[model samples]
Target: MNRERLFSQLVSHSGPFDIAIIGGGATGLGAAVDAASRGHSVVLIEQSDFAKGTSSRSTKLVHGGVRYLKQGNISLVLEALRERGLLCKNAPHLVHSLPFVIPSYHWWEGPFYGIGLKVYDTLAGQLGLEPSRYLSREEMMELLPTLETEGLDGGVVYHDGQFDDARLAIHLARTAVNNGAITLNHTRCTGLMKEKGHVIGVKAECVETGRQHEIRARCVINATGVFVDDVRRMDDAKTENIVAPSQGVHLVLPREFLPGESAIMIPKTDDGRVLFAVPWHGRVIIGTTDTPVEHASIEPRALPDEIEFLMTHAARYLTRDPRPCDVLSVFAGLRPLVAAKNAESTAALSRDHTILVSDSGLITITGGKWTTYRRMAEDVIDHAEMIGGIGVKHCVTHDLKIHGSATVLPKDDPLAVYGSDATEIRELTAKEPEWARKVHPKLDLTCAEVVFHTRHEMARTVGDVLARRSRSLLFDAQASMNAAPRVAAIMARELNWDAETIDHQVNRFQKLASGYILEG
Candidate 1:
């Protein structure tokens, strides 16, 4: 993933591409990987770093939607369940099975939910993980030591997939690049290039450098997550908005709050939503409240009420209540849900993806979750072939190995999340002992990981390195702030940042990270 070489290719390409994708998040990158692996000439551009928006800010679960099953959207649940299984198979290093316990307080709650989970397991069929089983009160407590137990009857445990969302996104981008797709971060799509009112290409500008390029494509796919409508309007000004943005917020807490391998799942909350407290990267992440938002943002903030809502629920479930002061970090992501006519609540809207070909032949794909990204890519590219008149190539991403894909990893090694690439990083640490130094006292991140991401993973800014590449900012905001100077220094040495650039990057990251901390 050499940005300089890719950028030169973007500038010097003589002919129009078979596919030009806008928005380098999950959908776009998936499309790039799917299309390119099928021998299509593909190019993708993102305004910011990959997964900077909703893709990175996820609940970190790769599972069939249990809530959707209760709502009777059986098709969605079935599709997501298949995709979830495939993701675990394809990216075993990043995605794995995680146990979830649903504590039951009432007599009837056990049978009711237990039957529902049985159906869930049935839907997954051969691809399912361990089956759901009933647990006695003693058994449940052993799994979740901190669960509140005043009227606890028993519990049911089920299996789902868990992963690092941003890390997977980076892998997806790398897989696309490995398959010969040019993916550029910090490249903004300014406008659509139209001939005779037919969408042909895009006018993009380099955000780092002011250089611009007119990239013509036979097919232009808009996979821009929450900001899909923004790109659609470039084709037609009067394009009625199709996306109804919904915000989901999560809070990161210490592992002591959930000091176990299994996670806690609240089947039903006061607002008819589900809440989860899952463990990731040595931290406990409890989320998420789904609230409707008018517009999408690059950096979404957790609402005061949303924070309070989570705190109230956390107190209800945990024996030890977590207060605002206990919060380590908080983040928010907006869903690009396709709007339903007369849809009163965003929660009722569809999680299934929608692909629309506009009057000008612009192919737009929106309204999907992270789990079904590969399927969405497959569908949109099939549509592109029919609409854009590109040569047909069947989808090959189902069995394609993501970059750094590995089956087994050492459990004690903190760099295991890097998959096979961890060995190279370990060699770097062995060669240069300074690279192995911890970035912060509280975090497992090392300076070697920062240098590696900047050199190979298209990491450009301190935010890109801390927020996405290493997930330091999401893990602990204050610690990430304290470690910013060290990270900027390492990136400076690797990417040749001057003293002024180092100061600017560190200051900018501190200001951004401060918002993730709840004021005591």
Candidate 2:
């Protein structure tokens, strides 16, 4: 349904809800889905589009933190590993088994990561994807033909899971709706509502229409990710900050850069953190520097140092280094790390999530890895049930397949993106063949997909079309900019925009797309 209808429907609700989640990112979306699955009345809202924040800007791995395993946090590793398995089982279309190769420059490196990976595998028990094994230089060379093999002795192969993070968020939201949860994006929780000194609801604003509403819920969940502190203070003005925001950056390159099924895992970087070079959506995805930031921001950019950090490190390992000019798109995300006792470095903090109840009864869940989001949700909703005194129930997400997901996806390009729902696109193509044609020559995306997103996925603007719905903006920034007019035209028709609105959308998309292109 369109957002206008969503607002009217929510405004029409006269009774209190069993649960009201205040963010549409991973944890919040998961909570909505879980709470609804247990038969609780649910309503969720996001200030921006779904997955517009840190949720969409992930490393795209649903892995058990191999780094956590090194830190001797076996329990967390075990938990993430099991969740990784369940995600693959439930949403096989979005999440799947991926092989990772840790290439060794020194002789000891292979055996070192291999042994650790063996322990990682053992922890998974029956849920493990594949056993970690030592690969000869020949085997490693065969898998990753582009690696610089001068000092490479051998490598280790292990199994992990990778997924489309933003798409998964959308699926979770849809699944939640399927299970009777009402949702809206572009809706912000401006304040918390209290009665007798306990939070009873929230004061939310429709960001688009400038309309205000009081959403009275029996329980309010603060799943605002790195922005949890902002929501927490709404309940108590004097509370200390609870989240230590950690920024991470990633660069997207053409898939030819990796040209391998197995991803490259640099177990350690110059800064004592792990980085990944993974293949995602026909592109090579390289990332991640963990540096603590003083504040959380909605529009976080990759610092120049972070860009250098990723390129310098990644270039060292590849046969042909990916220069800034070679980068197709660069995006940054913040990790919501729980504030620790005199934590010196965000990299030193735990990736595990935290759930806290303020004195005013605002339930806040924050600080976790994307790999363990479902578990994080289950924990939050368990507490949600406890705090709200709602009936206790089990989390069915362990085996719950996401919406539009399938047992098998199409083997071809574009259509494969829709997973089991690819047939729907095929139907759209049948009606108007031009909808199936690419907006421009370089991209493989079809116009029909844009129609599908607006008609079904609640995409209302050019940014939603490029950034989230189709990921055109994420894969290739300049190309998305080049295709903006055509995309805006399609959106203008679907959204019924006037000339000024269409121009605004095209200009806004262009400005945003430029950020993804690194400056020389």
Candidate 3:
């Protein structure tokens, strides 16, 4: 997890690695872990901080694709269901089971979804959390006190996995590093290194120091989510684009909007998409509108229409309607969906991953959900070994314990998300009393967490700490903006930044936080 040590390993190694992966999001990080654990010398490079893109901007659900199941994608649903169960077992500190109530306005709605969810449960088999069952109108209201009850006949309650997406991404990177993989953030891949029309390695440059390295490898993997085509074109200018970027947006609201342990799921929205209002880290996340986009950006903005769509739907389900001013923060993520020929809408694209080996032997893996990243990694590495002539090493990640995996954390502990690492962080507060002080009055982030992320989590920028490491920006945009000066000061002390750099960090973060605020 130490950036300097990892960077040294990248440059000092003379021989080619077994695998060199481009992209540090879910799929790439997963592949790094899978390959390294199997005794392959692996290196993974990212253009920015890990999960700075779509991985951190998820709706925070790790479940079988419910909408895909309705679309008759049984194979994907089955695969995701199995992976969901495994993730809960593998990363117990980050993943947890939660209940979701699908409210039914009409009587038939309850029976219809009830039967459908039963099939969903049957597909999960022994791995199912709790069986889906019908709940009476009175019972449903008790579970969801904030739900609108006028036309509510009853509801069907089901089970799904919930987690902190960015936190999980960090754990995956740590797991890969623990298995001896070289993972470098803020390193951009400039171009492919080919030998006589065969892919060999990559030309990468350190974003911070501008030092370039010609990194050779037996195999190179392009797992760069939505921007996969951008890397593909590097290998061959005539490479056909496989990814169709689909943008999904979410809005954060106060806990009072939900005020319960259970979540509400609208099975079918007006646009035939599913919407979820899930509780996470003491805030309610009401989201997700999927809209087609022509291009992808590292920081995608929540469109006005997407924001309005979520608020409109939130008003329909919640007794307390939300306003544009009520929005605490808004964020968006782009899905790296493999384009389908003649596919009318991005919604129709499959969640299953697609693997392509170019004529030059460059392996590209794109198009998969966060829930099934492990399976996608296993599949890609198996392909890499076959093409690269590496000896067979069967996948061991199915039972591999991710870094920081531990028993259930105490419910009141705020740092429970850090799992076993929470004990070390707690010790920091005891050693340095100033570290215990909250950075923002409205949020629980503290100076110790900021320092910890900077030193151990490869956090180099203020945005890396606020946006991904601690999730302060996603929880409350204005509070994070107000807290930036304090966070930057703490980071400056740790990273040895001058007064000018500190001011620049604070100002830069404020501008970034402004995009998350609707009024700004």
- TM-score of every prediction relative to native: 0.99, 0.98, 0.99
Q: Per-model C-alpha lDDT, please? A: 0.92, 0.87, 0.93
What is the per-residue lDDT of model 3 for residues 1-520, given as tens digits with 9 covering 90 to 100?
A: 8999998888798899999999999999999999999999999999998999999999999999787888898998999999999999999999989999999999799989998999999999888899999999999889999999999999999999999999999989999999999999999999999999999999999998899999999999999999999999999999788899999999999999998899999988989899999998989999888899998899999898898899999999999999877889999999998899999998888678999999998999999999999999999999999988888898999999998997568645789889888887888999999999999999889989998999899999999999999999998999999999999999998889999999998999999899999872
Ten-residue region with minimum lDDT total, candidate 2? 407-416
Note each model's CA RMSD in angstroms: 0.9, 1.3, 1.0
- Over 4 Å off in model 3, which ranges? none
lDDT of 2 by residue, 1-520 (tens): 4566667778788898989999999999999999999899899989999999999999999999998888899999999999898888888778778899999989888878888888998999888898989999999999999888999999999989988888888878888888988888888999988999988888988886778989989899999999999988888889899888999999999888899788999989999989899988889989998989999998799999999999998888889988878899999999899988977798778678888888777899998878888888899999888888778888788888888776457434566656767788789999998898897776777898888888878887788888887778778889999999998899788878999999998998898888899877
How high is the lDDT of residue 422 in model 2?
A: 77
User: Clashes per prediction?
Assistant: 0, 1, 0
Residue lDDT tens for model 1, 1-520: 8899999888788899999999988899999999999999899999999999999999999999899999999999999999999999999889999999999999998899999999999999988999999999999889999999999999899999998899999999999999989999999999999999899899999997889899999999999998989998898888899999999999999999998899999999998899999988888999999899998899999999999999999999999999888899999999999999999899889888999999889999999889999999999999998888988888998999888886458545688778988887888898899889999999888888887898889999999988999899988999999999999999898888899999999999999999999997
Off by over 4 Å in 2: 410-412
The local lDDT score (0 to 100) that residue 485 gets in candidate 2 is 97
TM-score quality measure for candidate 3: 0.99
- Sorted by lDDT (best first), the order is 3, 1, 2
